[model samples]
Target: MKLSSLQAIPRCFHTTRWSLVRQATADDSAEALDAMETLCEAYWYPLYAFIRRSGYSPEDAEDLTQGFFARMLDRDILTTADPGRGKLRTFLLTCLRRFLAHETERRMAQKRGAGLIVSMDTTWAENRYLHEPVDHLTPDRLYQRRWALTVLEHTLRLLKDEYEDKGKGVLFEHLRPYLGLGVEPEQSYEAMAAKLGQSLTNTKTQVFRLRQRWRELLFEQVSMTLDDPSSEEIKAELSELMQCL
Candidate 1:
C-alpha cells in the first residue's frame, strides 16, 4: 500500500501491525514475493553499507548480505512475522541483526556457504554499497545509514503502489535503477527509456517526481511510528534506534 493509502486507513493504533499477518497469508507466493521485492529494494543497500562499516571487505559484505536475504526467503521469515508485538521495522532489524551476528564467525571468508543461496549480482551489490563515504565510519554512522535505509524502504513501497495503480509499474521498475540501487551509468539512459517506453528526458523528469513523492511518504511513515511524538522527537528516536544497529 502507498502512504496515501495508508493515510486513508484509520490510524487506529500504532501497535496494530499484527493485522497484516492475516492479509499476508491470504495472498499467494507471487504476492508475497512482490512484497519482499519491495522490501529488498528499500533495504538491501543500508544493510550492505552496515556490514561494510562493520569491517567486511566489499566482496565479503556483499556475500554476507546476499546470504542474509537468501535465508529470509528460504525460511519464509515474512510468513512468520509477528507484527502485533511491535513495529515491523523493529521486528525485521532485530531478527536480521541477530541472525548475522550468530553466523558471522562461522561464515568466515568463504564463497557461497552451504545452504539455499540465491546468486545475486554480488558485483552489482558491491558497486551499490560503495557509494557511501567509507572514511572514518563509526557505529553511530552505521546506525544513521540503517535509519536512512528504513526511510527509503518505506518510501519505495509507497512509490510502487502509486505507480502500480496508475499502470506505471513499468516506469517504477525502470526508474528504480536510478533511485534505490543508485544509478548505473553503464545502464544507458536509452536502455531505461526503452524499458519504460519513454524518452530519456521524460525518464529524468519522472524520476525527480518519484523522489519527491517518496520523500513525503517517508516522513509520513516515520510519523506513524511515533507515539510521544514530535518530528524532532521522532528523528531523535530514529537516531537512537540506528545506533543499536
Candidate 2:
C-alpha cells in the first residue's frame, strides 16, 4: 500500500521513528547523519548474526559488517531506499547479502576496524551468537528470528524506561513476566498486592493496563518500519514478525 493513503492516520508517536529513515535518505546534514547512525546502532546486530550464520569467521563477519555500513554511508547507498518497495529490514538484508556476495574479498583484505561506522559491542554480540540454537535453520531464517527478537527487546526497553520515569520501576519489575502470554509469574496476584501495598483487584488492573500499553507500544514500533502505516499493513507485519518467533 502507498503511504499517502495513510496520511490521515495519527502519526505523532511515529514521526520521530519514521523521520530517522526519511532523513537518512537526504543529503549529509547533521540531522541526516545522526538519523543514519541511530538506525545502524539499533539494527547492526541482526545483520551481523546473518553474516556469522552464513559461515564467515567472527573476525571476518565483524569486518564485513563494519565495512558494509561504512560503504553504505560513504557511497550514499541509502539514497536508493524506496519505502514504497517494502520494509526497511528487507532493504537492509538485501543490501547486506549483495555486499557479502560481492565485497567479501575486498573487505577482508582491509585492516580490521579501519573506517568503523558503528560502535558495536563485539563481546556481547559474540556471546549472544554462542547461545543461539544449533539447529539447521538457514541463515535467512536466523536473520528473521533475530530481527523479531531485536524489535521485541527494543520495545520492552522503551516500556521499562517509561515506567521508570514515572517512579514505578519496582512495579514494572514485578509485572514484567506477566507481559507475555503463558509465562507464569513467580508471585500470585494476592502476594504481589501485599508487597506493593495495593488491593488484589488493583494489582490485576495494573497488570491489565501494562499489557495494554505494551500492545500499543508494539503497534507503534512496528508502524515505524512501514512505508504505509495503515492499520491493515501494521497488523500484517506484526503477524509475520510474531510468526518468526
Q: Over all chains combined, what TM-score does candidate 2 have?
A: 0.87
Single out the weakest 10-residue window by summed lDDT for candidate 2. Answer: 1-10
Q: What is the lDDT for 58 in model 2?
A: 92
lDDT by candidate, in order shown: 0.59, 0.78
Q: On residues 1-245, what C-alpha lDDT tens digit does candidate 2 reach at each position?
A: 12222223334454544456555656557776676777788789989999999998898889888988887776767668786765878888988988888874553556997768899888899999989999977889999999888888888999999999999999898898776533565678888899889899999999888876777777787877766577777767777887887
TM-score of every model versus the real structure: 0.49, 0.87
lDDT of 1 by residue, 1-245 (tens): 22222222222334212233224445555655454555565566666677777777876776777777776665667667553443555655666687678775676444654452343566776676566555676744664666665675666877899999999897677677655444543366677678767798987788677766765565556544443234554445455544434
Query: In model 1, which regions exceed 4 Å deviation?
Result: 1-29, 79-85, 108-121, 134-143, 146-216, 219-245
Q: Candidate 1 clash total? A: 0
Pairs in steric clash, model 1? none
Among these predicted structures, which one has the highest TM-score? 2
Best-fitting candidate, measured by lDDT? 2
Q: Which run of 10 residues does model 1 get worst, by summed lDDT?
A: 1-10
